[model samples]
Target: MTFQSTTSGIWIPLITPFKAGELDESSLRRLVKHYSSIGLRGFVLAATTGEGQTLDDAELERLASVCADETSHCSCEMPIYLGVSGSDPRKVEKRFQQTKHWPIDGYLISGPNYLRPSQDGVKRHYEFLAGSTERPIMIYNIPYRTGVNVLNETMLELAALPNIVGLKDCCGSPEQSYDLLRCAPKDFSVLTGEDPFFYNAMVHGAKGAILTGAHVLAHVHLEICEDLHNGHQKLALEKWNRVVHIPRLLFVEPSPAPVKHWLWRQGLIDSPEVRLPMLPIGDSLAGKIDAAVNLQGGTDWRI
Candidate 1:
C-alpha cells in the first residue's frame, strides 16, 4: 500500500456523505466503490472538501476503513491519504500517534490553522510531524484557510525531508505556486488543491491535484491530465476550456455544498448534507448545478 510522488495524479478530496446528522457509511462506501473504477490516482479521506473539520475520529476512521475495503477489491490498489490538521505541532504529533495504524497509506496534513504561526514555526511544525511517523506525508499548504502560507523557501526545506513527499498547494498566488513548482525537487510532487487552478498547475509541471470539483466531471479532469502527459496540449486546453467554469460554479456557494449537491443530483451520493456552519447548496445554485449536470450528459458516469 505504499505511494510516492511520481504516480500522484488527480487525487479526489472526497465529499463526506452524511444522513440525518450521522456519518452516512452506506453512501460513503458507494462513493468509494464508484470512484475506484475511475482512473484517479488516489483518494483523500476527510479532507477539507470531505468536511474533515466536522468529523470525529471515529467517523474519520470509518471513512478510511470503508475506502480501504472498497479499494482492496479493485484490481489496482487506490492509495488513501487521511487528512488531519491542527493549530499546534504537538497536537498534530498526537494525531499522528492516533492514526498511525489506520488503513491509510499516508497522511495529508494542513498547516496550523487560525493560529497563523511564523514561517520558522510552521517549518518546525511540519518538521516534527514528518519525523513523528514513518508514513509518507503530503503537506497541505492551503494558506487561505490555514491563514499562514508556507513560503517556497520553507517548502523547499521541507521537501528535503524523506517523508514529506509532496504538497496540496493552495497558496492562492500563481507566482508563488510557479516559483515553488520550478524550485521543487523532482521527487517533491506538487498537487494543486485549488480546483480552478488545476490546468494552470498542470501546465506549470505540477505532479497533479487534489481537487474537490473532481467529485464531478472526474473523467474529464483525468483526461486533461492525460492529454498533458501525452503532449496533446491542444486537446488538453480544449477540454479544460469546456469545463473550466465548473470549478468556479461549484464554489458559487461554499465548496462541498455545491459539490455535494452535484453528486447527490447525479445519484452518486444519497444526500448532500454538510455539517453545521456549512449548509447544503441553496436552490439557486442547485438549479445551476442541475442544468450543468444535465449539460454534462445526465450522469451515467460509471455506466
Candidate 2:
C-alpha cells in the first residue's frame, strides 16, 4: 500500500516508557493497546515527547518495531511515525540516511532548533532531507522550542514538493496557520503541533494535530476531532475545553517530565525517569499537575 497518514485524532506523542534504565517492550505493547481501546488513531513514536533527541538509532528502531507490531495488530489500525531531527543539518541528514531503511510510515522532522536557520535555509533543509528518504515527510515547526519559525510562505513553497506531504504547525500563531489553511492545497495536510489549539485547528481547517497531551486523554481528544468532522461543532468545542489547559500543564515543567509523572501514576510505566537537565516535576509543580489532573477527572494524578 502507498504511504498515507492515518493520523487525525489523538495521535499520541507517546512517552518513552522505560524501566530499570532499559526499554520496556511490554509497557510499549500495553500502552498502544490502551490508547487503541480508547479509540486513539495512531502512535507517534520517538517524537520529542518520546525524548527522540536522547534515543540512539537502535533504540528508535526497537521502539518503532514495537509500536508498528502492536499498532498493526490492534483494533484501531494505527500508523506509527518516527520523529527525527537536530540543530545540525548534517547531523539530521546522517539520521535520515541511517533510518531511511526503517519500516515507519513516515518521518516528522522539526526545523533546526537553536541554530535558527533562515527561511530559505529551512526550505532547503527540508528539501534535502525529503530527497534523502523514501518515507513521506511531515515538517514540524514549533518556534517555542526550535527558535526558528516555518512561516506560511515557506510552508507553501515546501508544499509543492511531492514527498513533502504534511506539516506539524506549532509556530503558535493562529493568523499564520489560518492563512496556510486558506492557501495550502488539499492534499498537503496542515496538522497543528500546538496541543491547546487542537479543536480550533480542526474547526479552522487543520487536518489534525501531533499532541503530547493526548497521551493521557487520547480517547476524549480523538472524539473531539471526530465530532468536528462529523459536524458536531458544539460537542467538539465542549470536548476541547475539557482539557485545553493540558498543554500548559504538561509543558509547565518541561515536556515529557510532567507527562511521565502522569503515566507512572497510571501504572503504565516505571519511575517517572527523565534524562539529565530534565528532572522530575518538583513538589510544587507536582501539586499543580495533580490539581490539573484531578480537575480534568483524571484519577492518575500522583507524582
Candidate 3:
C-alpha cells in the first residue's frame, strides 16, 4: 500500500506476550482481536514495545504471522508493520530478505543504534535497505534509543526514496520535527513515536502516532486523533486532558513492564511476562495502574 493512504491514525507498537518462557500465541491473538475491534489503524509487531531485541528470528516470524492471521479476521483488516533495527547494513538488509515473504504490509526500521553512524552513513543505511525491499518503509528516527538522530536534511533525502514512505519521528527535537513537517513531501507522512507528544505533534501536523501507551485506552487516543483531524482542537485537547498522564505512568519504569501489568489486570493477556533483562512491573506502580484502571472503569471504558 502507498504511504499516503495507510500511514495515519493510531498504530499500536504491540507487546509480545510470553507464557512459561515461550511466545504466547493465544494472548497475542487476543490482544490483536481486542485492539482491532477498538479500531486501531495498524499494528507494529515486535517493535521496541514488543521487546524486539529479546526475540529470536523465528520468534519474530511467529509474532508477525499471529498478528497477520488475527487481523485478517477483524471486521476491518488493520495493516501490520514488522519492526527491524540494527547497526549493520548487511544484517539489516538480510532481515528484510528473511521476512520478505512474511504476512505484513510494511516495515518500521530504526536508525543504526549503539555505533552511531554519521548522518551521511545513516542516509546510506536506509538507502541501501530501501533498495533491498519492495515493501514500504517507515523510518524510525529515535535518537534516545538509537544514539543517533536522522537530521532534517537526511530525513528529507530519505523521504525522496519511493519505498521510504513515512517516518516514526522520535528525533526528540521539536525544531527538527517542525522543519521536516514543513518541508516533507505531501505524500510522505510523519508519525510521532513519542507518546507524551502525541497531541502536541498532532497540533503541529503529525499524521499520527506509533504509541506504546496506546495499548491501553486506545479508543481514547483514536478519538483524540479524530477530533484533531476534524478540526475539533478544543474537543481533542479536552479528551487528551483525561489521559495525558498515561505515557508518564506507563514509562515510570522501563516500558512494556507497566503496560503488560495493566493488560494483565484487564485480563487482556494471560501473564505479564517479559524476556530476560526485562522484568515485570513493581508493586507500587502496579497499584498506580490499578487505580488508573479503576478511575477509567476498567475495560468497560467507552470506545
Choose the strongest candidate by lDDT. Answer: 3
**Residue-level error in angstroms, candidate 2, position 76:** 3.5
The lDDT of each candidate is 0.87, 0.78, 0.88
Which portions of model 2 miss their true places by more than 4 Å?
1-7, 291-303
Evaluate model 3: give its TM-score.
0.96
Quick one: how many clashes does candidate 1 have?
A: 0
**Ten contiguous residues minimizing lDDT sum, candidate 3:** 294-303
Error of 2 at 207 (Å): 0.9
lDDT of 1 by residue, 60-125 (tens): 888888889988998766888888888877888888888878898888998889987889999999
- Model 3 agreement with the true structure over 67-89: per-residue lDDT tens digits: 88888888885888998888998
* TM of each candidate vs. truth: 0.96, 0.90, 0.96
Model 2, C-alpha of 108: deviation from truth (Å): 0.7
Stretches of candidate 3 exceeding 4 Å from the true structure: 300-303
TM-score of 1: 0.96
Which pairs of residues clash in candidate 3, taking residues 3 or more apart in a chain or in different chains? Answer: none
